[model samples]
Target: MRQTRFHGRVEGAAACCSVPGCSEPGEFRAPVTPSSFDGPGSFRWLCLDHVRQFNSAYNFFAGMTPDEIEAAQSPTAGWERQTRAFASNGGDPMPSWGDFSDPLDAISARFRPTAKRQAVERFSGAERHALGVLGLKDDTDLHSVRRRYSDLVRRYHPDRNGGDRRHEKKLGQVIEAWQTLKIARAFA
Candidate 1:
């Protein structure tokens, strides 16, 4: 007795090959139609030899074009449909920064030290802050402000600092303070 393969075969009762004029026990199942319209699909129970013959002659890409065949072979062929990244948005879902009110600008401004000047015995709030920024004495006047501005510019200028930018930001702050204090009513 030969050992029969019932791996995919129906249990309990063996089906006979559906080929015309044949009496072999059908041990394997094949699709009855290349493309099926029915549910679970119609299948033909074929014997070993017939199923082998059917598989050898089957043309999976029978009527497909060359491009269609190539696309079908690609690994990413149906990935877009599966991912559905553009299903709702029609493209990327991320909003461009230009489209929204920038939060970074607001956040940076919040963290930045406000330029509000403090009230001093003589100078106003603005003048006090400016003096602090320029490292000047509260007793300093317009002439002293000009002199200090020139001196700081000389000391911190990139050219004077041997092309180092370390003090450039400080130099800018000093210049701004001088501009503010020179025109101040106290200095006038």
Candidate 2:
């Protein structure tokens, strides 16, 4: 029925304090040996006064090397460890920001296909047909169209095809498509 001052005081504890020559009731627990990867080591019980003395003398960095102590005290101590990477969204891999001189342009590049689709929707049927005939995408710029037209001309032109007339029909289609797309407002 004795009143105890310490928070860890064990009621009805029969064990005597682990400290020699002390007869006080062992009411508080302290580790007798440091724990290891194998298991938690042993504990010994002590009275309130002895436990307070033990706590005042305890040093968590007691056996640690100077380097280990310094590392434990560092602000970024645990941040160097690698963590699980975020799962990708199954789309095109994001462009690395470091590769682009302009960060905003890198962000815009991710949404460019959607912007191209919106532009494609504004094109007239003839313009769209011309784009298809020239084997170009809806997002093709005038420069790209010109480059594609030149490549097609060199491929299908009878003079370039070793004077073979077999590709003359395809060559005429490419020229006509270029003519139509060149005058289209979409190219402008």
Candidate 3:
């Protein structure tokens, strides 16, 4: 015997129109509320026609205020809204270094110690390498480092150096050298 698959109405269980027992087969799954309510309940099984009727007559947010309605209607209402950051002048001297009310912005604007300053402070290893590459003598100090870095940057920086292709590569080397020398504490 082949098993019969149920494709439509179940046979003769009073299967009323499913619209409060109007005596019809429940053909559609309809809900009183689109959202989950407090208690466990059941969804209504209705014929397609009645379900359409019920849907047309239903006022989902009938009792809600305008604000409540707006809040409830949107998927991202309360927290997902993007908030504008206020001017940083209100608090700390550091504009790029303060906390934000929103966690994401606070994280994004997190305090980053200036890399250039760090490079200037403790670049001994990088300095030696830079000096070796640039052929500078042992007496180079922070002042010399700054001056050489500035001069090389000016001469080779793509923007400053009339688009010389060779200087582009040279500029990169110069920056690496300067960054290296700047970090040596002895120079500081």
lDDT of 3 by residue, 67-89 (tens): 99988878876777789998877
In model 3, the Cα lDDT at residue 85 comes to 91
Q: Which one wins on TM-score?
A: 2
Query: TM-score of every model?
Result: 0.38, 0.40, 0.36
Specify the highest-lDDT model's number: 2
Ranking by TM-score: 2, 1, 3
Let me know the TM-score candidate 3 reaches against the reference structure: 0.36
Clashing pairs in 1: none
lDDT comparison, 1 vs 3, better candidate: 1
Worst 10 residues of 2 by lDDT: 114-123
Taking the tens digit of each residue's C-alpha lDDT, what string does model 2 give over 22-115? Answer: 9999989889987999899988999888999999999989999999999999999999899998778756566556434467866876767653
Where is model 1 more than 4 Å wrong at Cα?
Answer: 1-7, 34-38, 82-188
Candidate lDDT values, in order: 0.74, 0.81, 0.62
Candidate 2, 183: how far from true, in Å? 28
